[model samples]
Target chain A: MWVALSYACWGISIVLALWMLYDWFKIDTTYSEEMLTSSREGELEAVSEKHRI
Target chain B: MTIAAEPAVQVQGDRVSLLRVLGPAHVWALGVGIVLVGEFTGWNFAADKGGALAALIVCWIVGLLYTSVAMIDSEVTSTVAAAGGQYAQAKHIVGPLMAFNVALFLVFAYTMLEVSDAILLGDTIVAKAGVEGLNHNSFIAATIVVLAWLNYRGVLMTLNVNFVITAIAYVSIVILFLSVSPWTQGAVLKLNELVTPGNALPYGWIGVIAAFQFGIWYYLGIEGTTQAAEEVRSPARSLPYGTMAGMITLLIAAAMTWYVCASLMPWEYLGITYYPLWDAGKLTGSALLENLLFIATLLAALASANGCINDAARAWFSLGRDRYLPTWFSAVHPKYRTPYRSILFLLPIALAFAFIADLNQAITFSILSGVLQYTFMSINIIMFRKKWPLGSIRRGYTHPFHPLPAIVLFCLCVVTFFAIFLGFGSQLIAMVAFYFLISLWFHFYRYKFVRRGAQFTMPWPKPQGY
Candidate 1:
């Protein structure tokens, strides 16, 4: 029973990992390099905003 | 196309960045969480080499090493304000070649540490439960997976969890210290154990030098807090306070751990025992302390693994973003605003190390890689100050007694390499050769992919000496 639970955990991780890879491919195919690396969001936020508590 | 100097407000819809949501508290959590595991185990090997007193002295000596590390890192990281921490600093201060090596060091250091933590977490659970046929790999995979998912979702949630678990593990050490009642004049401790001449320095002064390598286990990953620079809301304010606070916390915790364990047990036994805190707790004959120490051990591994996942992914992400590696790994999650691909990509590599690499080898690699970074940091800071003098560019937090700390850190790193050689001579030589081969690959093949001008992201003026 304990062995089964451990395998179950691995199974969940495999599924999650696959989902991430799928998302990765989808985004890669959808966006151009110009759009993807155009500007860093943190730099933009740094200019005018501070995180509110 | 060049990255614009002006803030690109219009690109927010298409090109996302990591969320700038972390505060100093989270920064403290990230640094302390990665290091608190050392307080649980791996440090007592020093006691085995030199003796309890020697281990304590080496611990302070290593504390100085990491203090210099934290000081240099805080000053640079605050000004750089990038995700890759030392790698980013290398790119701006040094050049692409050094940056490539720093990235490799960051990735391997955290990834291997993560692997060690996961394996330990799995083994600890199985050992504690008295399970006969449980697969340790399954628990290891799950620990990595869940933490990666949390990291993939967002930095805030990942570090928030780190804060809670790291705090619990830290408090457990304090509980053990108080329960022993060290202030009550040897209530539960065998004070005589400390003064036994044979027990204090059995192997002589040579043993003290040998003990220096394991002393690194006391504060291995505290400098990792700087990896969160880009995500932090206020780098200038947060990095210095968080990094220094984390250092002070580790110093106290390390001393407390040594005091409690060294006072309760003879150095000969304490040196060879795995999980010295747990053993010390058992010596008190209190089931409550023993069980709590067990739980604390488990939590420390979990916390360290979580922070490792966070740090390793960020370094990989920064590398990708700058085209140091393939650009495909650079994408941020559109909605989650996290480096989802980088997090998932490092998952398999960490798992591979966890299963195939010997735990001791993995840890040695991690320590050696960290020492390489510290050695370079001393050089990096001196260059930083020389190229960009005090008033040349603004600094978030400047370390005092300029050049002294850098000199001390460099000297300590050289000493540590000798200590490592005295014990694991072959591993030391192999690590140097491995890095050498990879540096060649980056120079010969990978440099073409990187955009040289765009790589210097900081808006500072041309360097002074340049």
Candidate 2:
């Protein structure tokens, strides 16, 4: 029974991690349209802060 | 009156801001980076309390609790993006005094964690390389200088390095797992036998309670991810997703790391070992694997140190910039937009403490402060929701079950905090005394100098129905 519980814990944790991995990879396309529009503002800010030290 | 002509009136160009250099990947790395060291070390201490099986159970329970907290914190971060994080959450919901207490809890806790991480790195290297008479104090101080310089360069550079170091650390875990995955129930010591009640959970049910202090290691710094809310792009979405990834990754890593290591030996043996992974690698009977595991453990500690230093400095920056603390902490590198002055100010102090502090005390006090900070943040969530009701506020995300999760977590933290304190009588008393001292200190600072009508209302997300 204890062994079963141990494996069950591991199983649940692995599933959660796999789900998060899937979510992490989807970042680029999830908000592609918004990303495109915002890129212009982001570019100017990036340039301004580029050599910040 | 022309807005530009009025010195008090600020324009868009005049508002100083942190650069949005972090994307989803950077946020994910930083979230995991700050806490990933849990996989390498610290988990074994729980074994001392409740044997291996009890410790494993403790890790699982703590992992779930922290994951829940991280999810709730995600919504708060997305709605009101700021460097102040939980501190800012309290300010909007409770008031400045509560906000002050929360900020001090976070700042001091992370600073302590940073110091401890550096010390751990120095000690781990000394053990790994077999260097006698090594000046770890000098080693830690030098390492902090390099880390601070990296941070001063820019957030982008600091996070990029974090991503690389974090990735290597994770890969190391994967390697260790794969190397031992094929072992058949441990030729050295079968896991099932080791977990039998008298063996794995020697102290009985009460020992499980004692184990929670160490259980905190698995997910302690995962919440530090929210400290990066101001730096991430599309914070509403990115912050939540990044933290979810980080929590899930840590949960899995903790379980696997515990399982494989415990499979090799009894908690009696593994629990006392200074480097569990390095020793666990020997059960595979491969020298190459052992060395690889040891190196990975060191890298993991370094990554955590990097993240903790960055998180602590940012917290100081937010406080200093808001005039809650000294304005000197608010000074940013003119070009990099990073809080160089704040990082430098705390670096020496952290280094000094790292040399004298004990490992157990570092872990306990960190969790103690966390207990206070999270309690305030969770209650703040309930209060904020009450003030703005569902559909009344323009929030980035809505948590299901309203404030049930917050209330549940707050109660759980309170109960668990006191329960864990049962084991650390002296430390608990000392922490409470220090807590009072700081409260008095903050009161003096505020009462003496903070003038009337000088403070402005926070720009929290406006309530739609209001």
Candidate 3:
């Protein structure tokens, strides 16, 4: 049981990491640097300094 | 009228921001969760350096050091309000060079700690299963990846999970303390264990000094609450309250853990063992207590690893955002609004350290990084007050007894460094050389990339001295 669980953990982690890599590249290609770095929500929040839902 | 300046960075695309959903409770969980794991394991090394009584004494002394750290961190973090915590403070108060080094310190400190936590969890599992020489790599990788995934998803869910697991571990310590019933005549605790000859101070006063480095285990990383400064719903209020509350909880927890363990086992045994709390539970001969402690140890490791992911990623992301590393690292997840790239990037680094498998070596590296950061903190706050004196800007919280805390903090950091030298001298020199080299790299290559104009995010008046 323990060995199987360990193997399962290893399998799950590799899958998750691969998924993250795929998403990371996809996002990089899709968004412009200006769009990516400029934070719309952060600007509004920084100015007001108020909590938002 | 208040100054209404343009956004710190200009852009031509849709907006993305980290969720501002955290409150005081989440802040407490973030800080305590990262640190409570120490109570279960690494802290007993202090007994090895001195003795049981010496460990207790050093615990209080180190407690005072962290109290100073919390107070100073709260004041600056409350006003600066950024993700990198001390890195952001260093940028505004000192300069880019100092900020770069501080950011690196925060990254390494958390990452090494995460590695140690994962290794401990893996070893515990193998031991419990009665297995011999099983490879722990898979479990270590699994632990980092899982926590990194959670952090990538969102901060709220990540910290909420931490809060639950951290609370359980804390309550277990309290239960163990009560079960020992030190106040009762037929108590399980052996008060004589403390005063038994060499147990009090075997190596004498110098030993007490030597114990200072490990004493930090009792309350390391409590200042990490400030790393959540950006995500907090109200930094001004939540940062100070959450940080102080976490400090108080750690002091109480540290005292009780020492009392329970020091009383149950001989000083020599307690000093050398990695599973002091669990061993104490076994001594009680209560099957329930032993199992509770076993589970608590596991959960505490998980909680610590989880918080380390959140903090290390934040500091690294903040550096990327400032162009100190690469702007590629700065991108926030469009949907999750988390620093997804930074989280994923650190996964491999954490795994590499975990594979090293020397828990003591890993912890020493983490502690030294932390000590350097704390030393810089004392300097940063002194400069902060000098540059922007009282009434210069709207400080969210102001630390009392200004130079006193800073002075004491600086002095304590010096003593801790000596303690580290006595134990891990070569490692100390290696870390210093490492930072020194990085500082050079930043001054030459990296500084060219940093957008200096945009570095100052706060809209405060001109600094008085600068």
Candidate 4:
């Protein structure tokens, strides 16, 4: 039973890996300068107010 | 045919310029790394302290927690995509002091791992050549030069190495599994569940805790991918997805290796040998299979060495850029665009440590810092949403359950970190803690590097001067 379950997990992981691999190739490769100009950019907050210079 | 990035200052405002050619797949490959050597060899050590089942249970827990952390980390990648990567995330959420700590940990861990990889390569080469008294240092130096050259060439070439190394590694692992079908008719495939007097669980529960220290090694370097987040093409999309995908691949590799090794050999026996998979192939399979695994071990180490160099430079680049270190540390080669100087800076340190430091001690120190880095990532998540809020930070894929993943991962990481340090004898932990305090003192008091805003890239719509 334990062996079966371990195999099952491995199976799921393999399938997920294949999916990731497929997506890895299909996803766009070019750097998107537009991404910088489209999202909210200026409302920046320091990570920690206590430590910020 | 080519989509050129907009002018550096126009889009990024001048303080940024890494050629972002890496896509999601490249990022994913980098994330999975060459192989989880721990899962392949070192994890059995954990089984000595924790029963086989106990070791397996601890691995499951650690793996699942890391998956959660990755999910949360993806959110970080989406929000603040910078060359600084996780250190930047920590900077944005925790402050430069904590970022400084995390950065040092990453730098130390990567350099230390590279040392081990180089020594392991030397050992493997001597064995393969069947040559006595091979000058190991020369071979190690040659390997470092090759690794450094690949990285110095730029991200695309370094990435190209990742593609070839990772493919060979995966193929080798497949070959190993096929050599002996532990899931089926292999003679050693039985459960060996006789829990009578001297069963697999001899040390009982105490053993499980011991086993986990090694078990965590399986997924140790996956987070190094986060270092590459800055160089990805569409980091917002690729970083989150790539990281999670990498984690899943490692999980599968870990499970397959654990099942095969545990089923085929006595857990105690597996712990003693350095090359568990290579040893497995020797005992049960043909000579050809044993040779393949021997080659696999070297190839995997090569992949890891290459990965460490690239990521460590980026981490160093981040520190240099932020003025935490000397400015020259982050200086880019005019032609390569890669941080050539930073890579060089790490090489000497890596060489020194590789020759002098014990391999086990190197791995242990690397793990200690790795766990702390993970804990810092979780803390970044907990503070990130609050620092930027919903409207301020763009949502690529928000991790479900808000802070649950962060909280859970933080607990697991800290406990593991403490346990491993304690195992090294409390004095080592004390020294590390003391170093931590000294760094904190330096950062809060004597450290004088002020932030000179660079053309930092944030995942927001409108470009802002960083």
Query: TM-score: which candidate is best?
Result: 3
lDDT of 1 by residue, B1-466 (tens): 1111322232354556666778898999999999998888778889987899888999999999999999999898888888889999999999998988998899988998998888877877777668777768888888888888888877878888899999999999999999888886467887674648756888898888888888998999998998998878789989999999999999999999998898888888888776788888899999999999999998999999999999999899888888889887787776566777789899989988898876667778888889899999999999999989888889999999889999999999998988898888898899889989988998999888888787887889999867
Model 4: CA > 4 A from native: A1-53, B1-16, B185-188, B193-197, B427-431, B444-446, B452-466
In TM-score terms, candidate 1 sits at 0.93
B219-278: candidate 2 lDDT, tens digit per residue: 778888877877776678888888888888888888778888788767887767667887
In order of appearance, the predictions have TM-scores of: 0.93, 0.83, 0.95, 0.82
CAPRI-style class, candidate 4:
incorrect
The lDDT, on a scale of 0 to 1, for candidate 2 is 0.70
Location of the lowest summed lDDT over 10 successive residues in candidate 1 chain B: B1-10
Candidate 3 ranges beyond 4 A from true positions: A40-44, A47-51, B1-13
Runs in model 2 lying further than 4 Å from the true structure:
A1-53, B1-16, B182-189, B447-466
The candidate, 1 or 2, that scores higher on DockQ is 1
Question: In model 1, what is chain B's TM-score?
Answer: 0.96
Instruction: Tell me how far the alpha carbon of residue B389 in candidate 1 is from the true structure, in angstroms, after superposition.
Output: 0.7
How much is the lDDT of residue B365 in candidate 1?
Answer: 85
lDDT of 3 by residue, A1-53 (tens): 77887899899999998888888888778877666665421353553344325
Each model's lDDT comes to 0.85, 0.70, 0.87, 0.67
Clashing pairs in 2: A52-B335, A52-B336, A53-B336
Q: What is the lDDT of residue B131 in candidate 1?
A: 77
